[model samples]
Target: MDRDEAEIVALLRESVRQQRMWLMVVVGGAVVAGVAAVVLLPGARLGAPLALAGVGVFLGVLITAPQRKLLAQLGLSRERAIELLSRADIAGRTPEQLRERQAQRRTMWRVVTAVTTVIAVIAIGYVVSQAGNRVDDNVPGSGPTALFGWALFASAVAGITAIVGFVQLSTFASLDRAMSAEGDEIAS
Candidate 1:
């Protein structure tokens, strides 16, 4: 195997590892939420745990979307893909093809990051605006505190999404540049 292929394999392995970690988080969150829901079933605090769980699930879904597309592109299931990666098999991918896909994904993630950054800004702005509002202590989840919590949660999630996407975009951009340089050196 060439250096480029080795790098691609290593990168894919790292990606699969990260995805699995995220999956674990999603499952762990769901389990925690389930327990919380059962314990708080008779109280007004049920919504908070459930809402947090929903956000976890949402983030998991969003993060897995690119993996799903890549799986489709490679015509492999998740388990099979991981297995192939373990064996250092890239499902018949060429460096050029991978670079092209990387470029396309970088472009897509840049757009997604931009959108999420905007959302984070808006959510943070709303949270700040609501910070000074008078609170009704009689309500459980209907007070300013609850509103602030939810808004802060939303903004945090959006900020996380933006950061993740931006990091991926930057990584892909760097890899593409390195690959291009390698190709140029090889050609010369």
Candidate 2:
């Protein structure tokens, strides 16, 4: 195969691998958060910031490595990837069409973000409103305050991941199909 097609194949492989990694991050983060909520279950005031910062940092690490790999494999930086894919997309021919396609692709994630926002608002509200429940140290999960705080935390992590992953999935996950070149095309 030609260099370009070979590079595309490498990109396809990397994309699949990175998608799986993010999927694992989502599922695994859920499990970890569930356990932490049950075990430590920090109070509302404490959990909110910790959860936000902790999850944010975790996802940052999860996202950073793949770029290096993508660059190494396809010699394509993130901007180049976006540019190539956008150029190849039919709707990308016009500004309006490109915006429409972007909106269509982002619709699911936008819904997810909205739902998660509502959940977080409600969770933080309930947790804060039950401000006195933190001292119920005798029983586990009895503190609705802490439970909701942890729930919000977990939701925040998963929500951010979903939004980012969905966008990346819509773009990068389709690499093979997007840049596919077969037999004579590759040879040429």
Candidate 3:
């Protein structure tokens, strides 16, 4: 109802929208690359889809740093506004309830991160296996060797991206923990 509430809501909505857009970009890139790989590389296994998927993964990692920064800024702004309201005694009887809600949110985030880490690990394993299988199926000629090499390179890129994603996820989890701790301290 107030200006601060409106601003917080706007920022939250914007963050969600940006994240959704990022997901679309990642999915679209993977789809396009997969199609191209299938059509362009006749004998190649894994096709364009997998290759595009690798590219998509890499781009997602590249974008995550900026995304994290945006999230941190949004969180800090919101927290500071809440702190200001609490200090001014304007939040009335709901401060404890708000703290409880934030704690629940932190717990939910931890669960989400844990699930995401597992899924990412599974995806990396799947991609690696698919790449290896494709490389093995190709005959022992120069062309096959070249294709295998390209596939290997792409797989490596994807692996690095996966690593980055894991690291970012961990960083976010830690940030969440730290924020929760700080919130608890403030509430006390």
Candidate 4:
């Protein structure tokens, strides 16, 4: 109803939009690379990890670079965070408030990380178990299938690491952008 509420909505919407863009980039890149690798390198055995990991790194850079640029343009300095909160519906938060917010965020990240780790472990176990079956059964060129299985496992790990790494590094990325802006200001 108020101007502050409208600003909050706009900021939140922009945040969601950015997240969607990042996801689309990551998912689209991954799918295309995966299909291309499988098609172009059939029986190559190493295609999965190579293609997926490369895509992961590329997507990470693409997302982070734009995020950093946006943070700089938004002037997301510590002072600005405090300033924005000052009129947004309540008085500005104190240092303790900021610390509490960070602690809560860290807790949330820990929970998510723990869950993802469990899933990854289960996935790795499944892949390894399946790979072992070839050896147990002593099938010829089981070698290639086993190798391909490992490649799939590695690809999964790489993709998971990329997404989680992006989430964890976000704060530092914003800080770096803010600091860069400050340095530019000082120089000019």
Candidate 5:
């Protein structure tokens, strides 16, 4: 194979490896968190989301693993392999397509992050307003303290979601810009 083909193969292998590693880390962390929540909270609902997240990650990894393996085992031509990878949603996306997808995703995430941030702020305000009443509220899950705890938890979760959304938005925006620049360079 030519140097370019060799480079593409290397990149594809590295991409698959990195993706696998990242999925493993995310799944492991989610499982640990879910188990801890189940053990600590018992009947509480905190573990549901974590369990769901872990399942989703596991499913994604499983769905992509076969494609990566087939690509390696097929020994197809480079272009054909790349096209197959693209069909599998693995790699070989044109810069224009990538840029467009990134722009759309960033726009959607921007709106979502904004809404979540606003909700988090409102929850925070409610928590602050109810803080004074928490002094005498000593019930398990049915009083001012319980309300305060739920509100605080909601605020924390929403805030973290907003932060993660913002980070994803920024990443997509940056990727869009980079792809645009790469397209421009290719065109020139």
Candidate 6:
């Protein structure tokens, strides 16, 4: 309600936004690395595209956490600002108003979580499938060098999936918190 509190909320929002921008940078770098790997590494052509795609998917997972944090913070801040404005105007609140606001916030969070989860799952599955294909390409007649290349591709995909899963879990936690906050608001 106070000026100080408003300032702090603004700062927090800004910090989260900045973090999201930085994540974009990291994602771009990963894409470049994936391309370079394909071009420079011997027999890496089959693996490069898969690695790049995996990196892109993993970056989405990584960005989702910060995105959720920012959304939560922004939603709360907006709600607080509205409440403060209402108080200043001496406007009476109705149950419908409260319910609408709660519903809007809930919908926002639900959409974000559902979309991100779907994307992450699809990406993970794609990476896994690509790795399997690469392995199959390394059949006995494919030569020892191709087999080694396939092994590297599989390892890279596995590593990317592990990291993406961890990030996705963190994002899911943020979504849970947002949902809990909405529930508490409705109860009170």
C-alpha RMSD by candidate, in order: 9.8, 9.8, 8.7, 10.7, 9.0, 10.3
Model 6 poorest 10 in a row by lDDT: 141-150
lDDT of 5 by residue, 135-156 (tens): 3335554444434555776798
Pairs clashing within candidate 6: none
Any residue pairs clashing in model 2, and if so which? none
Off by over 4 Å in 5: 1-94, 137-146
Top-lDDT candidate index: 1
> Which 10 residues in a row give candidate 5 its minimum summed lDDT?
134-143
Prediction 2 global C-alpha lDDT: 0.62
> Judged by lDDT against the true structure, how good is candidate 1?
0.73
Expressed as tens digits, the lDDT of each residue in 15-132 for candidate 3 is 6577788888877776687568767876566635676578767787775655567547655555664464445443454656655655676566566556655655665565566554
lDDT of 6 by residue, 8-42 (tens): 54555566567678787896786576567656875
Model 2: weakest 10-residue lDDT segment is: 175-184
List lDDT for all candidates, in order.
Answer: 0.73, 0.62, 0.60, 0.61, 0.69, 0.58
- Supply the global lDDT for candidate 6: 0.58
In candidate 5, clashing pairs total 0
Give the per-residue Cα lDDT of candidate 6 at 85: 47
Q: Local error of candidate 1 at 134, Å?
A: 3.0
Greater-TM-score candidate between 1 and 5: 1
What local lDDT does model 5 show for residue 91?
Answer: 58
lDDT tens digits, residue span 89-188, model 2: 5532654555466566656666775676666567667656766555567987675644665666656665576566556556733643444443237659
lDDT of 1 at 158: 93
